[model samples]
Target chain A: MALNVLICDDSLLARNQLKKSLPADFDATIVTASNGLEALTVLQTQDIGLVFLDLTMPELDGVGVLEAIKAQALDCLVIVVSADIQPQMQQRVMELGALAFIQKPASADKLAAVLHKYGLI
Target chain B: MTALHFTEEQRDCLQELVNVAMGQASDKLARYLATMVHLQVPAIKLVDTQQLPQHFAQRYQQQSVSLISMGFFGDQGLRGEAIMLYQLANVDVLARLLEYSDDDSSEAEMLTDISSVLTTTFLNGLAEQLDNSFSYAAPRILSSRDQHFADKLAATAQQWQLALQVDIRYQLTDYSFHCDMILLIPGEAVLRLRQMLDQILASF
Candidate 1:
């Protein structure tokens, strides 16, 4: 089965940038949400396997989303892609249940390496 | 509203750039105070000189504020100003955090120190991502006492018509400190900035 992917961010530019940086060999179908609430709606309605989450959004933020995912025991892997590079933030998100963290303006190599590390691609 | 001259894509790009830059700045501030810093999504607009005070009223609402300004010169003949407006209400709490004495000079010095961290971290982050170099002047206190910042700015900018304003707010987790940093790209600098934005868009 082709896994479904979700990219959630408030900024359209960030969404597009992350979308374009996906490794060529990654075969998941791409889905998108502009904020955390929209992301939750999609997660509930679809069989998403992976998610790229951003912090510091309007409505519910990425941390809120992670907490909800943990509370709901959602069945998808979340990798955080955000501009909030504080060590504490990174630790908090990973503790909340993100599989990994990637800084903003992510490169294809970094994305590919993480995917490979987890055998997602 | 007369031809703001920024395309939706350019504006989106600028906002994201600001998000990254402001994120770095907030991290710097958070580490400095050893507290979580909350950041508002950066707001960008082009406004006439007449509307500046309304913006002030809408955001600040007659609050006493301290202000500082720094000028930045970009390599592409782009020049603009960075203004940091610190709310005056919570100075005592912040003074305790910084361990500064309660004298006016000490307070002024502390404000400048904090302002220096924010302005330089943010502007340098923006410049680095844009692949441009910049030089900065020493920080200047526009109004560090009882004066209203909006009134001083209105009097100062009567000769101008348009300004590209990027407003960022930072508040500590305990609400013991607050500040608004406004970056203004004026006149021909706006044109240069638009070109830079387009170039960035082209790269991706």
Candidate 2:
């Protein structure tokens, strides 16, 4: 079974980089949203298994998306890949129910490790 | 060159780059201050350099502020000045947090130190992504006891015809610290940055 993945970020370059870094063996159908609103819209309409989220964005930020997911009781895992790597932010996201946190410019090994730990890949 | 335009994709790319770079800089400041750092999405704009003083006056709307200016240049023809603005009212709180005694010399040292972390760290992050490196001139305090923010900025603003401005804010809610860091990439350097951004986008 393939996991449906949603990569949410405002930057086209960041979206492309993350898409390229996905491990070759990860079986997932990837969708993308430019900002948090679009991300929530997709989550409502599609069966997304995992989300690779970015922190700062124009309309509604990554944290807002996390809040929405929790409020709606949406069933999905979130892994934040953001440039804001403050420990405080990491703690906040984890408390918000994110499965894992990866820093921006995420390496393939790190992504793979997180995926493997959750047994999602 | 070419009206200093950044395409939609280019603009998005630049904003993200600024976001990442600012994240690093603010995180460092947070650790140094022993407080959590909050960041806003960076804003990117192309503006006429001659109007920079007015731009700062209108956007920031501060009567008097402290300004630190630093020059940064890379091997790939990208060079610019980074200006960090601190509200006069807020610096005292930050100074106390850093444990600097209340004195003019101490204030200058503290201001320059903060500027270094914000400017160098951010510029280095940008250069790394572009596969380049930057050298920086020592950061200088542009505002003095009697000088105002806009007046100090006007001296250097006229040198460039157009500038790519990236406005970044780092907020520390705990300490009531809010700073506005702006980067001005002028004329030819703006063209160089556009080309570099395009190459990064194309590589994928």
Candidate 3:
């Protein structure tokens, strides 16, 4: 069975950029959410195995989603793809259980490397 | 009052960092628009918040402009707002570049979207160079029509006496439209950023 993946971001452009960068060889059912609230709904209702999350969004931000995942013990891996590339911000997310953080304008090779590092690819 | 001061070396370092961040923003825009975007060497200034109105009035008087403002926070208590200013007359050109249908309402929406993307990209680029991460709030359209630029800033101008302002001009190579993006870091955040700069300089 193919893995389930979720891409959450408020920008349509950003979501499309990440979606376009996904490797063709990767087999997964990709889902999308524009905000933290929508992402949480998807998480609760779907068996999403991986998520590509953006840090800034309306309604709820990436950190809020991480907190929700931790609170509920959601079974999934999250990799943050954001433009807020502050080191302290990166450390905070890592501490919150994100598998990795990638900077935007996402690239295929970087995405593939992170996935491989976590044995997700 | 002791004027906020930055050593020549510190000023150079900060300017260089802003240059790199602006480069990243320009590249993203170039790719998105599939056109050449020219970025000017940013002019950096440290000024009192109260004096910003005079600054804006002198530089942008009588010109209609749009301002988009967003707040960002760092774990080390570094916080400030990023504001982008565009001439209202350039809205039509911008809409064309972004490939949006030309209309009044869509033009407003396009400005917000472009502002959000540009601010996030630029801030993230700067943070990446400093090896820091920031949490940003959703960008808000502070103003969208012809107005005194300084008046809009006055609404949320309190909280800090000193601020570091970086002014950058983005112009398309083949177009007459241009934008002036100003990044303002308040007194507290400026202090924290200087400390980080010191650490970075020490390592080099």
Candidate 4:
């Protein structure tokens, strides 16, 4: 079965970049959300297997989304992709059970490596 | 001058870090604009709140400016604000460089988008070098028109006793446009940052 992936970010440009970074032949049903609230709604409505999350956004943020997932014991994995390259932020997400963290302008190679490391490929 | 909030070594380290971050931000801008963006040697200073208004006025004069500002926080109560200021006269020029239609709405949207990317990219670059994680609020447009930019900055400076200011000049070589990016880090954050630097220096 193809994994269900969600890309959540406020910027159209950033969301597009994350989508493009996915492996060309990767098999997955991808969804997109522009903010944390919408991201949670999608998580609840869809059987999301993995998430590419951005940190800074209005309405809700990446940390809030992570907290919501943890609070509800959601099964989906999260990989943070953001321009907020603070080590503490990365540690916070990881401590909250994020599968991995990737910086902004996510490249195809980096995405592939993370996906492979998590055996999501 | 008043006693320096940061020791010379700490100041030097911070300047180097800011330079690296500015370089990364400029590279991203270069790719976005499809042109080379040059950054002047950044000037970092620690100044009192009373001096901020006068300092900004002296630097920017009477130019109407557009400002994008955001707040960021990290572990151990580290926090600061990053503000990007551009002369209002160049908005249309910037829109054209970005290949957007020369309309008021388009210029506004493009300016916000560009500021968002630049500010976050620069902050993230700095965070990575410091080996720390930070969370930032979404960027907001403080002003998008010609106005007393210095007065506005001064008013905001009232809440803080001291601030570390990093001033950078961003020049778009292919286009006749350049702007100043200023980072205002409050004294508390600077103290924490100094601790982090000391730790790093000791490690090395």
Predicted structure with the largest TM-score when compared to the true one: 2
Q: How badly does each model clash, as a count of residue pairs?
A: 0, 0, 5, 8
Best by DockQ: 2
Off by over 4 Å in 4: A1-121, B1-4
lDDT of 2 by residue, A11-49 (tens): 888898888888899999999999999999999999999
List, residue by residue over B91-202, the lDDT tens digit for candidate 3. Answer: 7887877888887678778887887777888888889877888889988877767556678776656555665778877787777777776666766677888898787566
Top of the candidates by lDDT: 2
Model 2 - which docking category? high
Lowest summed-lDDT stretch of 10 residues in model 4 chain B?
B1-10
User: What is the per-residue lDDT of model 4 for residues A36-106, given as tens digits with 9 covering 90 to 100?
Assistant: 99999999988999999876666888889999999999889999986545455567889998889886557
User: Over 4 Å off in model 2, which ranges?
Assistant: none
Tens-place lDDT per residue, model 1, B116-178, is 888899898899888987789998888866777887777645545566677787878775677
- lDDT (Cα, tens digit) per residue for candidate 2, span B91-192: 788889999988989988998999998889999998988888999999999995568778778877777667667777788959777878767777788888
All models, DockQ values?
0.69, 0.83, 0.02, 0.02
- For candidate 2 chain B, the 10 contiguous residues with the lowest summed lDDT are B157-166
Whole-model lDDT, model 2: 0.87
- Distance from true position, residue A46, model 2, in Å? 1.7
Assess candidate 2 and give its TM-score to the true structure.
0.95
1 versus 3: better lDDT goes to? 1
Off by over 4 Å in 1: B159-161
lDDT of 4: 0.77
DockQ, model 1, C-alpha based: 0.69
